[model samples]
Target: MDPLTIGILGFCALFVLLFIRMPVGTSMMLVGAVGIYMIRPQASLPVLAGEIFGEASNYSLTILPLFILMGNLAGVSGMSRDLYNAAHSWFGHLKGGLASATIVGCAGFSSLSGSSLAAALTMGRVSLPEMQRFGYDNGLATGAIAAGGTLGILIPPSAGFVVYAILTEESIGRLFMAGVVPGVLLTALFITAIWLIVRRKPEKAPQSVTAEPVSKRMASLGRAFWIIGIIVLTIGGIYTGVFSAVEAAGVGAFLALIVTVIRGAASWENIRDVSLQTLKSTGTVFLILFGAFVFKTFVGFTGIPFRLTGWVEAQGFGPTAVVITILVAYIVLGTFLEGFAILVLTVPLVQPILQSLGVDLVWFGVLIVIVLEMALISPPVGINVFVVKGIADNVPLNTIFRGIWPFWFAMLLAAVLILVFPQIALLLPNTMFG
Candidate 1:
């Protein structure tokens, strides 16, 4: 009958719903509604309606659709292929070069598409066959693509960061800026992991018979210049304070449309397809956010976050110990939960605890995104691995899972470095926003 008891039962019921294959957003909404009604009968329906209107009318969330549109347009314009080709021209001759190139290409595409599934699906389609043609082992090839795709949520324009910012009421621009260094650091670590993999098992990735000529490589880079320019124009504009994150999203989407047209890739069918896909993705995100807000409100009413924070204090856990404990829980949850689900489900409970500990939120955002990145490749429900498996249908699930280990470890290293040196996540945001 107590609020905390109601909250506990609600969570158990919510997980049972999830186990029965209910949609996350709907499940959250249902549990939250029932919990609210149980706690206060008259408040439940009005609160649900109010939260829906609040999330729907939020002006800051305008960035979501624009960014999603930009990514969809970029995908339709063949930018992912161009990025992969340019990376291949530069790195494809080295041991494990194609796999390395795949990581680089994923990083590049991540700048364009902020969704991990989009990055994984797009790059997996573009890079997998090329690696196969070159006789790269299926595990190494698919693993690189799967792991690399996780970069999409850590790089600028990241939907993960956007959701985090929205949930925490932090500055989205600052979060975007904060993600930059850590994203590049993770990319480099992924490439290094590939190098180590091939060093130990050279036969996994065959050396190219001959490297491409400098002129050809330069030409390939040229083909990718438009995408590079769009990235600079949007992300660079934000860094220099010339454009807000929302404005950058608009301009980026517009430019992507222009480039799509110029490349003669814009047909009625392509336009229709991209538009519909964007709508579907955007709708899904909004639904999740709506559920998250209602669930957050219910949790707030229960006062669980405050109690948890108090419990931590009573335990005399230092800030470092508290953070480690939270992250370890995240790692365990990441194995079974989708990244966004992990985020929306936990952040309402966790944010106050971190804030009470005087943790820098922007730095914590970067760290959280990295863990979410790790989730994308974790196991069982590692969605990025599934995305890769969808593309490389013949590659065994275990092989792809095996391949992602090194990159997953690389992600773990990135998290550790960011944890040790918060500057790795904070420098850009501070330099730009302060």
Candidate 2:
């Protein structure tokens, strides 16, 4: 068979392996190794060894563990509750206000953590019971937390953006700045989705206790200062060039450490748990990253990216059609593959097409992250839904899936808006850095 045929079959086989409960990193690496051996057995062993050790030592990746440490450390600290309470104080009286507060809390926590799974797990634990106590509809209640967790990837300090930056060779700071505006827009869109649902269904989101006195509200706001301060300093420092993404990660981790200690969660056991969790999460990411590099190397040898792009260009599709087709493919893939895997597998094929079309790589990166955000909430493989399910076990899996529908479509609308007005994803990066 020709190289492209082998590559195609290898791709399908990787998915099959994954479906049979294989680890993503192992699956990708196995297929890549076997494929490379088929083509060049003499070179395969050295290449695989180089990818494993070389990827571990890659300097660009130093930021990953630092960021993960900050998130895991901050997650254990009491900010999730503080953030939720702060948002609850301000918006709790509005229709769907508690649910809205949950989104706000998720957004704030995501900035601190840079992780969707951590955000979903933390916020689900913090907010679900409160929403349930408020007599909110189960679908609306679980759905809001599930959907809100998606922000973890779209907000600044996002691991997804960091990985994308590494893959695309873009400036991590600019990619991060690019995420800010769209992150805000999507947060608004999600809140709006909650509003429409409440407005139409009426009983889905009953009025919250918006009647708190000003003093009580101020107290709640005061409680969230740690979240606000960490976000502004790290993200703001990145925009102004006071810190590179790596530096920001280090500083964020240090500050989070200080806060954890100051809050007296500094017990050795707590620190150990946080550190262990950080190590595990970091290991998973890097393992997958290693596999991606090896697999991408193998794929590169196949010339599939070039052939695929050539064939698509030959068909003479309009720029808009090509873009739409790529996005539609992401949506479909989102239902089955995890977002990072989808990104790793497709970027090699898609990047050249995008570069050829004269698309802005930074803007496209932001768009990709946004779609991945939707993927986290998309049914079936909606990873965030599973995260929430692990915490809110009494809620049926289907109900959580049903609840996320509005937020999923809202994310789609947000993606459309960004495409129509590229500046939504570009404005901050362009103005702040360029």
Candidate 3:
């Protein structure tokens, strides 16, 4: 078969396997290996042959496990609970205050953990019961957690950004820096969404009587200072060129460990649990990466990316139109695929087109992650929704799905902001890198 035909067929088969519930990593690897053997066996086998071990031993990839460990350590040590308690003290007086506080907590935790599901699950445990106690509607309560959880991938130290950088050969530091402003902006947007919901339906989110004394509030805030300082030490170091991404991961993990120990939350069992969880999370991510690398190379050999880029350019749709189309497709695709899976599968086809248009890869990356953020809360295959449902099982699946729509729209608005002001995603990266 012709290379184009092989690429088309292979792509379709990969999707079919995914629909049939094949692990995305396994499906991609299978299709890639099969495509290569059928197309031209000689050149591509070496790439697939070493993908498993090569990515495993990759030095730069060390940042992933280190960052995951930091998050897991912080989680096991109750740092996440402290952060939520702090947000609650300050925001618990407003209608929907607890839900808003949950969003704030998720954002802060995202800074530390950089995993959306972790942020959601941790905050859900900490905040959900509190919100329920305050008579907050289940939909509003769960929506905030599910939506806030998406912040994990847009914030610095994001595993999604790490994967994008590795795939696009973009600088990880620049990508991390690019995420800072957008992450905060989206968090603010989520808070606004909660406020709007409660403002319109006052009974849905009752005001918490948590009007704690100023001194008490200040003390609570003080407890959160070290967490802020940790962000500065890790993400801030990357922004100022004081540390490489991998080094920043190390510094963050080490500091997280210290904080856990200092808080007297340390235990041999906690350490063991953190280590074991980190190992599991890191292994899942690495396997997908291995398979993605294999699939990307297979597609590259077929010349599909170049041909697709050439055809799009030849169509006179212009760069903006092409970009808008891709974004829309991603928004739709997210409903069916996990965020990371959509990313790995589509970038092979889309990155070349964006590059050909002279679009900045770093900015495009931020936009992609933002869209993926929406994907996490999207209907049908929204993984974070399912994650939160598992935690808040009393909430109906459709209700959980319904709850995310407002935040999903907020994320969509954030994407538009990034589009209109590309600087939202690029300013830090440019100021730092330039």
In model 3, what lDDT does residue 434 have?
89
Q: Model 2 off-target regions past 4 Å? A: none
Cα lDDT tens digits for candidate 3, 194-267:
98998899999987775899998899878877777887899889987889999999999999999899988788
Model 2 lDDT tens row, 371-429: 88888888788899999989888999999999999999999999999989999999999
TM-score of each: 0.99, 0.97, 0.98
Candidate number with the higher TM-score (1 or 2)? 1
Candidate 1 Cα outliers beyond 4 Å, as residue runs: none
- What is the C-alpha local distance difference test score of candidate 3? 0.90
Candidate 2 local distance difference test against the native = 0.87
RMSD of each: 0.9, 1.3, 1.2
| Candidate 2 lowest-lDDT run of ten | 202-211
Clashing pairs in 1: none
In order, candidate lDDTs are 0.91, 0.87, 0.90
